[model samples]
Target: MLKKDKERNDAFLAIGNIANSVKSAIAPYLDGVLIYVREGLSVQSRKRGSVNPVFDCISRLAVAVGQTLSKYMEALLDPIFACDLTPKLTQALVDMGFYIPPVKPTIQERLLDMLSMVLCGEPFKPLGAPQPNTLNSVPIIPKDAKDP
Candidate 1:
């Protein structure tokens, strides 16, 4: 059991630090991906001597997807950084597949699971460990609190 307050704090802090790093890395990396894909397609379009709707559509889609994902990561990381460690750990455990779901997880759920796996070690199987019914089901806390 999570007996020591210090241990809990340390675990939470370490995970928060990981979340912050993820937040820092995601934006630029996403932007770079968009830029690289767009530029490569642009060069190809130029080589072809005519506008390619396929390239244009793909570039637009990349920008839209990047922006959406960036916003979602920011949303996820905010609570991970500031909320009580109890909830964070609970959610992280669920994300890391410590628990089995009654239903299939959504795409966002899968992404969070991957993120949790990266931050935490391997997941405990539901049969091996007591499982939570849901993963990261905590309410979205708005960004009213100061950054740590």
Candidate 2:
């Protein structure tokens, strides 16, 4: 019985770890999807005259796709958390103005509050090795110099 309990615990731990990694990895992609949906809807709304039915249809289609993906991501995360904590975490996100409702919005408001601008304290600096300047670092051989 003890060994069986240990195996069950191990299974739960593995599942939790997988869920955490997936949540971290997919977050950026979901943000990109949200951005795409927002931009597509914005363009559709700016048409001068009666909107083309096809364009509007495509815009709605995009929004639905984005929403479906986002909800799936959330569903994945939900199982990782304790049942009681799930609603609390969601409410916290809502309080921070980061929650997007499941309801579809009019095209004009679809893009609103979807994109957030992040201000970095410092610019990113690449950690690559300093490249040697071939022209300056290498000594030039005279035209008459024989090959070594």
Candidate 3:
């Protein structure tokens, strides 16, 4: 059990590291966007509010960040699903009753669902509970669900 715990911890750390790395990579882009917005706002104020350049820049930056993070998250999900450590983690969660049956999804399914939830900025509700209002705009069903 000790060894299993260590493996689970390692896997969790690996996933966290990947998320941190992606965030770190985007930090410079975020900083540049902020600087541009600030400059634009200052210029607009000097020009007596005749221009709204800051909002445009902010919107573009937000879109770029969303796209980048979406790609990163999609890429991250596959490996996480395939990792040997995941099933063990899921089993442990189940054993502790953190994951309820009837609605118990496979490891891969759970991982994909989690990634989608995070990307959509939704709270991580377990499978059986009511999904939060934040997910109203995003589709929560699995892609494969439509087929079978």
Candidate 4:
């Protein structure tokens, strides 16, 4: 019912922080936490006080949940940016979980060697390698075969 109110953003964050503190214990109720958060940041709750707390709450929940927050990113971002999206707040959210660290280009490059071995069992050929030739279309000739 907290979502129905939309004005009690501070209260929503209070519950959110509690959820963060006992993360796994509240796993089943995580969606409700996000629901209230989204509601608090909704356009209807445009009060400066309400919006900022929601941002802080979002960042805290993100840190607590890690990549699990990624699934709700779209829902969270819409209302968040719809309110008072500042660079600092956005950065906080990204730092916590929005842009996962492993997906970064640096991480991929760092893992290229290990990933190649694990995924393909061998390194791929270089770009300069000659194009592979095919033999399926060629017919075999025997030494004893007479010419037509």
Q: Which lDDT tens digits does candidate 4 get at residues 34-139?
A: 7877766666666534466667776666666666666676566545544433664555555554444533343234234444666788654556977567796567
Model 3 Cα RMSD, Å? 22.6
Worst 10 residues of 2 by lDDT: 108-117
How many Å off is the CA of 56 in candidate 1?
11
Q: Which scores higher on lDDT, 3 or 4?
A: 4
Predicted candidate 1 versus true structure: per-residue lDDT over 25-91, tens digit per residue: 4444454443432333343433543223222322233232333443333323333323223432344
lDDT of each: 0.37, 0.33, 0.39, 0.59
Q: So what's the TM-score on candidate 1?
A: 0.18
Per-model C-alpha RMSD = 24.4, 21.0, 22.6, 11.8
Tens digits of lDDT, candidate 3, 48-148: 43212323322333333443433233333343333333343344323322322322244346655666665776635556986556857677876786686
Clashing pairs in 3: none
| Number of residue pairs clashing in candidate 3, backbone atoms closer than 3 angstroms, sequence gap of 3 or more or interchain | 0
lDDT of 2 by residue, 24-46 (tens): 44444555443432332243332
Model 4 residue 130 lDDT?
Answer: 73
* Steric overlap count per candidate: 0, 0, 0, 0
Error of 1 at 57 (Å): 7.5
